[model samples]
Target: MQKFPFDAIGFDLDGTLLDTFRDLGAAVNHALVLGGFAEVSVETSKDLIGGGAKIMLARAVDAQGGLPADEFKQLYKAMLTYYSAHNAIHTVPYPGVREALVDLANKGVRMAVVTNKFEGFARDVLSQLDLIGAFETVIGGDSMGKGEDGQFLAKPHPAPVIAAREATGNGHMAFIGDSTYDVRAARGAGVPVVAAAYGYCDMPPHELGADVVIDSFPELIPALEAIGSAS
Candidate 1:
């Protein structure tokens, strides 16, 4: 097993801790049909996710012949509502996620979730999966408040990573995720990342540039221990 160096760990929710594309794709397709757009396939929708809601809506709209900006905005709003209502309807934690989280928590390692999902939806998903209590903090794409200023800084940006650090009061951190966007975000945050080869990815894991890649969630234990030892 590969090992990493850090004191705390941050995770991307969707493809990292759970496989939530089914519910997200379903809601997106429903919204598209309601918006007078052609329905998209679940597989295609998977490609559209990981960037956040606005980007996902934009891609869905573009797939069905780009709608007028106002129409797109309206559709996006509706989509958000529908998605929030249906967020975890079909979501499930990835294999070994529960065990990995349990083990990490027992070890007294700080953990947080930094996802591009909406705060409400993300919380609902975690609750449904019975994993809400495992994390110290959960920051979604829409978690922007007074200090955050409502900016959507999805993966590939360090804002969410930094936010997680601020929330946990931990400077030495690592990110665990499954996409190039996650890798970029970790890099921008000046943190190392562990890529999950089993999660949803449109491209090869090698292209993501993660500091380490693991095939199973259990493999992260050694890495976490290495981090703890290094710290």
Candidate 2:
């Protein structure tokens, strides 16, 4: 039951706030078929997703007989386009997530979404779900533009978390997410993190560098209250 002083909370979109793997897996397998590769199991696709679009597509291609660089590049582009259009087809907010978020907002806790998903697609999904209004800021994988030398820094980098903090006008913040990448990003940003064990996680929650592991979104209230009391 670790506690911290924080007035804002940042969330990961896909696996953290929403269960979007069904449409994501469908798009991936559809792209694989169009690219002349065998379809992958949804379970395997789930394991490949939290990283990002390119990483997920690359892993899928590698699983179905690796493709040449040029072919992979084309396929990856197609996959992104296809996924963007189909992102919210069957996606749904994770259990208790909507209620929890609304409750937190009502309590005046600033919230934002920081995701490795593309900015446009992330926004689209949130908009379709009517959740766009819930976040004060939404930072996607491509939002900050390429780095100093044209390199992109996605999750596992502090940029997104720092950007979220800046966007929400909060110096004291906590990150809530589902995977190791989220943990790493929060750590790099020097913020405490809460891991959602109910979401998609490639590894055990305890090993993901979270200060607390919450089994349900509703647990968040108690956790935040404890932190407030401690502070």
On lDDT, the candidate that comes out on top is: 2
Candidate 2 lDDT, 1-231, residue by residue in tens: 333356689999878898988888988888899998888887667788787888888888887679899988888888888887788889999888889888778767789999999889999999999999999999999987788877567888889999999988866898989998899999999888889888888798888878888888889777766655665
Candidate 1 off by > 4 Å: 1-5, 145-150, 224-231
Q: In candidate 2, which residue pairs get closer than 3 Å at backbone N, Cα or C atoms, i.e. clash? A: none
Cα lDDT, all candidates:
0.80, 0.85
Q: State how far residue 126 of model 1 sits from its true place (Å).
A: 0.7
Task: Tell me each candidate's TM-score.
Answer: 0.88, 0.93
TM-score (C-alpha) between model 2 and the true structure: 0.93
Best by TM-score: 2
What is the C-alpha lDDT profile of model 1 across 1-231, one tens digit per residue? Answer: 443345578999887899888888888888798888888889767788767778887888886679888988888888888887888778889888899888777656688998888778888889987899988889887675424655566667788888898777766788899887888888998887888887876478767787677887888877655645655
